[model samples]
Target: MKKLRLAVAVIAAAALCPFMAKAQIDLGAKAGLSIPNLTSGSSSNPINSGWSSRLGLDAGIHAEFHLTKRFSIQPEIRYSSQGGKKDGNQGFAPTPEMAGAFQQMGQPVPPYLYATYKSEAKFNYLMVPVLAKYHFGFSPKWDLYVAAGPFVSFLLNGKNETSGTSQIFADDAHKQPLPFPAVDFTRDQDIKNDLKKANFGISGHVGLAYHLNGRSAIFIEGGGNYGFVKIQKDAKNGENNTGAGVVVLGYSYRIKNK
Candidate 1:
């Protein structure tokens, strides 16, 4: 499955090179802010687990090409970080039975079952956006254009981490033998692993841009990306969709060849 996904991504990128030559190529840099929203699983222990969307930063260089007078394609290489944190009173709180087992086994019981975690997942990739821009060249000083398209992004970094208490064992009995239902034991383990990294996903964008002369435009875009891959691998017991909103504000400059 991993091989298939990688192959598809390679093909998608190869298909965009020709389109680049067909459009008006503009080379420029753009910087923007990203708001990250994290969705994860639940815990039986009440250690105050919650995720927040942080304001992330993004910077990249791109080429904008006008395939047609009214249509353009933008392929960009960007480096950006997007992920949230679970902090405050968040950690692992072992049940009474579980704590007793750890004590009996002479294992070091964690002070808190849950601890704060930060996701520093970063990506460096080439993104291709074929935008259908409706240019309203009303006057020389002012022109408005509306654009929307399907954009593709690849994963360059898969860094991830998870921290929590070992609450499954009661006094080292975890090494012994669990006589109860196997599903219960599996559920506990699943939650701990679910707080890992997110898989790659797809996004769609729509926005309006106001052109400043024939070269530059500032735009604000709002949309959502539906993550086709599971963000949390072990959280099969809970919802682990990587769906996130795309909130960006920046400027694009059209490179004119002299």
Candidate 2:
């Protein structure tokens, strides 16, 4: 009976050792910069012009669950700012057919006229991401990690602003400006209703962490998020996808095992 009890105790202690060594939980806050842009679908209207990346912000809190010595899962809730800029020249000249029609009417075809338009779109979102992470120990106080995950975001607000200058020339040869005053205008509008309320996407990250102590650490990371869903709802032609690259700095605290 004594021998059997000794064997049982040994086996139980062996089973519990791995769990006690590997299981840990952490919570943290993070904030950073993001470069956001839109990817337009093939069927999208060319008149809308192309998009360029815009600078934005991201901030959030995250909870990490360590399942083993080298593997973990982190879930975060973050507020993100995203959007893009569009700048181009539109309605520059009359088409060949239009010019012919003017000649037939005996109306003198006025010199070519053109307008330059510059516009920006901004969006705010509440985003949730669940990431599976793999860690590698680089030293006693430093660690390197990579993570991949999926995320969903809800749009909180959106705005669009546009400004333009229209120029008229005295002749088609492009020399001499018309005496008429140049037209300049600016407009701003809320566009929440024009955009989809929710977006779904995949995200990936790579980062390095420095442990301040057994219970605390600081980390820096760079990653990107890509959306599969269209950003707009009432699109006449194609889809607009959202994508962003992010850089962040964060602090974390490990909860003591009771």
Candidate 3:
């Protein structure tokens, strides 16, 4: 009877070990700024100009599972706003042969014309990242950590806005010119159909946290996300991948292990 009772107690403790381990989970929320850009493809040029970085927002919730004294696995779900901007000037002039042809056709050619163009593309995505983190202790109250892993993002919405001004000149020699109306216009359109629905990337970050006690702390982190998959749906239009640099400030709380 004594041997049976001991055996039953051991079995009950063994069965509770997994559940007890999971009670050590930590939860946190983070919010910050992200600078995002679309990496231009080989086809990007003066005509189909490349993209530049734009400012956006990043916010997320994460769960961290401690595996050891100095290591943890963190999984996060985030809302990220990302995109790029393009701004520049382009000029066009009539060739001599073309000018002559226009004259023969009773249509005088404009000697010179130039346009200043500006455009921005905005994309919103839901992203999930699973990271492996290693912690380094500077003191009992301060710790530093570095994490890296893979992330998958789903595009929620996208838009593109363009504005430009074009001025036409009568002739290079005659700067005073005719009464040709300058063209100025702005257009905003939905671009979801033109972009890929999903994107996959590698993300990594380094941060420092200060422990207030055994349960809570504050942290700051800087990280970069680089997408390997193209974000454009049609490859023929040229490849454009997502890239972002982010900085976040957050607080975390550890749940007591049962």
lDDT of 1 by residue, 157-246 (tens): 443334433223222224433222222211212232334333445555566566775777776666545444544444322244443455
Give lDDT for model 1.
0.51
Evaluated against the true structure, the overall lDDT of model 3 is 0.78
Looking at model 1, report the run of 10 residues with the lowest lDDT sum.
181-190
Question: Counting only residues 3 or more apart in sequence or on different chains, how many pairs clash (N, Cα, C under 3 Å) in candidate 3?
Answer: 0
Better of 1 and 2 by TM-score: 2
Task: Identify the superior model by lDDT, candidate 1 or candidate 3.
Answer: 3
Q: Give the TM-score of candidate 2.
A: 0.75
Q: Is candidate 1 or candidate 2 better by lDDT?
A: 2
Clashing pairs in 2: none
Q: Which portions of model 2 show Cα errors greater than 4 Å? A: 1-22, 47-49, 90-114, 167-185
Report the lDDT of model 1 for residue 206. 60
